[model samples]
Target: MPLSDHEQRLLEQMERALYAEDPKFASALEGTGLRTRTRRAVYGSAAGFVVGLGLLMGGLFLHQQWVSVGGFVLMLAGAVFGVTAWRRIPRLALVDPRTGAPVAKRRKRGGSLVDRMEQRWQHRQEQQGRGGGF
Candidate 1:
């Protein structure tokens, strides 16, 4: 999954070439991932969670129904924000800064779709061998 330094440099060069050749296209697809923005969103969500926790504790101490309700709302909002940040912030920066292209996420190669299906079928048949019928 890790790219060699030479490959990384090559990819960077290719991307620059592509971008320079057509600024309009490159500009159109520009800025998909802003690190600072992602950081801010994530950090903001964490801060919201801390504040929400405080609100919840205060509401519990006071035993006020309205306070409790408000705290619950705040906690819910914080959780939603935290989830959004955790799920999406990193994904926003899809491109590798060094390569200027989307980084290839590594996944297991089980061969083609049909091959995988056949493998599964073979496995099932083996499991059902002597039994013969479903």
Candidate 2:
């Protein structure tokens, strides 16, 4: 369920209070730690891929089919791991650069194009009424 205006205001106040009271804890709770871990994982995966390449070349030079297959498997595993980790890295842009709080995503309106236009018109009218529309 969507939050009521009062509820949203209350939530915002609570968030601000949390930030004010212990920013370090709040930041830790944020997904930044996960992002960092995923980044490290990506780096590790890249290193693994390089090692796999070296193994593959060594196996070829030694005319070893089993070793060549193992190297190829490692390379495939590393590529998969790196891709997954890269995808898991949270978007930094979604976080507020100033307060380090996550910016709320705008909820998309559920309606037809005409309905959306009408809503936009209403919003513009409200803004003009508030003497801020340009």
Candidate 3:
């Protein structure tokens, strides 16, 4: 749903107020988008994984337990990095520079934990009204 004109104006006012209150913080936040950061994280992790693989192979060929352990650790860290980046990918949205508000409309991609819980609560209310019980 789109915001009413009044609501939009109110939001813009709030944004201007926030920016006026802390220009430095607002400027820092304007540096990059979530997608850009996510891409960088994914790329960095992939590079780490490649390096880890090389280390692992070198360690294995030389029969060095310590190097092998280090490689395994690196590989594990890379996998964790990649997974976290992937998880955060869906939450990316474009921000409006002028208002510092998200430009993209929210889509129902099952939503966050709070949204899911709110949905469940509404469903339960409807079921109760219908005299259904668990």
What lDDT does each candidate get? 0.69, 0.81, 0.76
Query: lDDT tens digits, residues 3-122, model 3?
Result: 886986687676556566775666556545676888889999988988888889899999997898899889989989998997887432244545666566555578799999999999
In model 3, which regions exceed 4 Å deviation? 1-32, 91-134
Candidate 1 lDDT by residue in tens digits, 29-96: 55545545767877887787777778778888988767767777877887788787667644322345
Ranking by lDDT: 2, 3, 1
Candidate 2 lowest-lDDT run of ten = 91-100
The reply for model 1, stretches above 4 Å from the true place, is 1-33, 90-119, 124-134
Ranking according to TM-score, highest score first: 2, 1, 3
User: How many clashing residue pairs, candidate 2?
Assistant: 0
* Model 3 poorest 10 in a row by lDDT: 90-99
Taking every candidate in turn, the Cα RMSD to the unseen true structure, in Å, is 8.4, 8.8, 7.6
Specify the highest-lDDT model's number. Answer: 2
Write down the TM-score of every candidate.
0.50, 0.52, 0.46
lDDT for model 2 comes to 0.81
Task: Give candidate 2 misplaced runs (Cα > 4 Å).
Answer: 1-26, 92-134
Better of 2 and 3 by TM-score: 2
